[model samples]
Target: MKFKVDRAPLLRALSHVNGVAEKRNTIPILANVLLEHDGETLRLTATDMEIAVVEEIPSTATRAGAVTIPAAVLFEIVRKLPDGAEIEFNQESAEEPLHLRAGRYATSLNVLPVDDFPAMVAGDLPHHFTIQAGELRTLIDRTRFAMSNEETRYYLNGIYLHVVLEGKKNYLRAVATDGHRLAKVDTEAPLGVKSMPGIIVPRKTVTEVRKLLDNDGADVEVALSETRIQFRIGSILLTSKLVDGTFPEYSRVIPQNNSRILRVSKQDLAAAVGRVAAISQERSRPIKLTVTKNHLTLSAISPDQGIAQEELDENSVSYDSDDVEIGFQARYLTDITDQIDAEAEFALADSSSPTLIRDTEQPAVLYVLMPIRV
Candidate 1:
């Protein structure tokens, strides 16, 4: 097979496809990317069994054929080539090595049998919808931080995406939790999404999809079945298997009657939490929050490091409920607060109950953080 392509376009396609190949693969072909040329365009595909990414770029081919080459090696070679350099690829046969040439630089990569490469068959995706790239990004960014990493409860290792009906309107919601904290965000459901089944999008798939959403105004076409989900972004296509386990009924964990309200500048609370948490040596790095009318104080103590405290009064916080003291893991507090804009509003029931947090500027996003004993 022989083909000629521009360095810039080839590098961009390789960069996207190479990430899907596993660095350590028990199967040899899983470590390589399949390249196919059809005289007019070249297609690059890489997969790690669970997820696959494929991208195509314009190419000029004199001999049409396909071969598999190590993804990392090909990516690095093209990435270092001079900008605007035209690259030529030549392979005598599937058993022979793949040769690459760019200006004065030339190299050959050991090739693998194209027949050994596995394809992720996206069987019969019945549900189809189109969403703005910006909206898809918002759903992922606001909730992915709370996804669980624990393997025991595999269901919680991804964001739960589902459709909900509120009165007359349909909404698409993304919910993620790691037991200690939960993030929930929703957007208006696009047409034809109401019939789609709830799916758990694995963490790795969420990350790869987000990386491709560089242009917010672009449209992303999504198609899904019960077992798999596929995303089409311009010339790139990503397919991933859905988590098989059923997600727990997350609504049960969201607090409903928490009425104590404390509003504070997000920047102030985050800074104070960071300062006091510095004193704790424990993994949780527990920080105590004492809130009263127009006053809030953050404190932390470690047996070896002593204690640290910071206070925010009427100037930075607004509170009018009975005094309450709640404890939270310092990292959890920062993660939730980081999603807030200028102001963060906290709804509390008591020191022992879960506290609800919200970005005052965005009503569609909410967070629930469980309290830890101080």
Candidate 2:
């Protein structure tokens, strides 16, 4: 196998696949990247059984062949080479180690048989659609923070992607929750996904897919089956196995009628909560919000340290309710508010009930936070 690739462009492609390769693998081939050259373009693939990422880059291939090399080692070598250096890869035979040459730097890496690299097979994926990369990124960014990390409830470990109808108008929705807080964001339904099944996209897949959608005007082609999902972004393709579990009926958990309303500046509320929570205990980090007719008081107390209190005025605050005090974990509030760039509306039924929060500017995204005992 022989090919010549530019250092900078090749490095970027390698970086994308490196994260998919398992760092510690009982199967030796899974830790390496599969490199195949067909005399014009070189294809690089890495996988960890659950998720697979493949990227193709233009290269000058003298001999069309394939080999598997240590992903980390190859990426590191390419990254350290001079900016404009051209990297040459040569593997004379299956038994010989792969040789790499760039400028005055040269080294050989042990190669694994390409046949051992697992091949990702996608059965018939009938549901096909296309979405703007920027729009998809926005939906994922708004909801991923609430995805659960608990392995026992594996269903909650990723974002739930599905299509839904809002007052007879169709929309694509992404919902995620960890039993503490929930985030739900929606976008106008894409062209051909009306019949797409609701799939649990594992946390790792969501993260890797987000990296590919950073380009604003790019269009991402999406294909799905009952058990897998595939995303094609430019010359890169990502395939992930869907989590084989049923997500809870999330709509039941969302409160529909919360009468009390509190509106405040996202920046002001976030800053106040951050300052007061400094003195909160490291474990629970509980903070209290006392709401009156026109004022809101944020306070937190740490048994070992001290208590902190701050009052935010009515400059960007408005409410229509009697006196109500609610306790919440400081971290949850900050996480929810960080995603909003404008004012936030908080609707509550009582101190014990779940509070619904939404962005005043973008109403399609909503959050639900369960109150905690302080």
Candidate 3:
């Protein structure tokens, strides 16, 4: 295939695939990207059997043809090229190697027949939804930190995305957990997803799509089927396989009715945990939060560094009991607090129990942090 393209657009498209392509694959063709030139536009496609991406960019075409080239090598070459240089690619005759030229520089790369490249059928994802790009970014940011990293329990390695009705109104809820802590965020369900089944989006896909959401105002076209999902925005298309196992019924984990409550500023709570977490090492990191009446006291005790404490000014807050001390991974507590976008909120339940965190002004999101005993 023969076509010429600008360095910037090609580089941007390849960067997304570079992360998805596994270094070790049974088939070498899986390691390469299929490039098809159809006179006016060039299509770049990559897949690892689980997810696939296809992006089309405007190009100057010579003779129409297609080939498979190592995605990483092509990306690196174009990325390092001097700016504003028009790239010319040609495979004029099957007898010759693929030729690349820009200015006085030239390189030849071995090519494979494009027909051998694997085919990716997107499936019939008839249900398509449109959501604000920035809103999707928020859903991912608030909950992704809690997704399970353990691979053995493959079901928990993704964010659970589904439609929910709270107070008899529709909303989109994202929930993630790693057995230690859990994060759940609720936003108004985008216009078209009210009836779609709840789906688990894999962690890898989440990380990739998050990067694409940079253009906050961009609208995302999302589609879902039984086995695969398609996310489209402008010229970008990301297709990924959904997890096969059933997601644990998360509702059982949420506290039904908890009476204990403590309202504290998110900023202050985050700072307090971060400060005391300095000496927490390994699994025992900064581990204590003691709440009494309107006064909040944070402390951490470590065998190596001993103990430390900090006090916060009191609010009108009152507790259901005398005093409660809860130990948490200083990092986990800090992370949970960072998800809260409110100044004042409550931490429900006792130090020995799972705590529910809520924002007084914004009740849509609920955060749960499992207490770690020191």
- TM-scores for the candidates: 0.97, 0.97, 0.92
Which is superior by TM-score, 1 or 2?
Answer: 2
Candidate number of the best lDDT? 1
lDDT per residue, candidate 3, 302-340, as tens digits? 787778788876653445456788787877777777777
**C-alpha-based local distance difference test score of model 3:** 0.82
lDDT of 2 by residue, 1-374 (tens): 88899998799999999989998989989999999999999999999999899999999998999999999999899888889999899999988999999988999999988889998887789999999999899989999999999999999999999999989889999999999999999999999989999999999999999988879889999999989999999999999999999999998879999998999999999999999999966876999999998789999988889989999878968986878999999999999999988899999888999999999998899999999987
**lDDT tens readout by residue for model 1, 189-223:** 99979999999999989988988998999999999
The alpha-carbon lDDT assigned to residue 173 of candidate 1 equals 96
Q: Candidate 3's error at 315, in angstroms?
A: 7.5
lDDT of each: 0.94, 0.93, 0.82
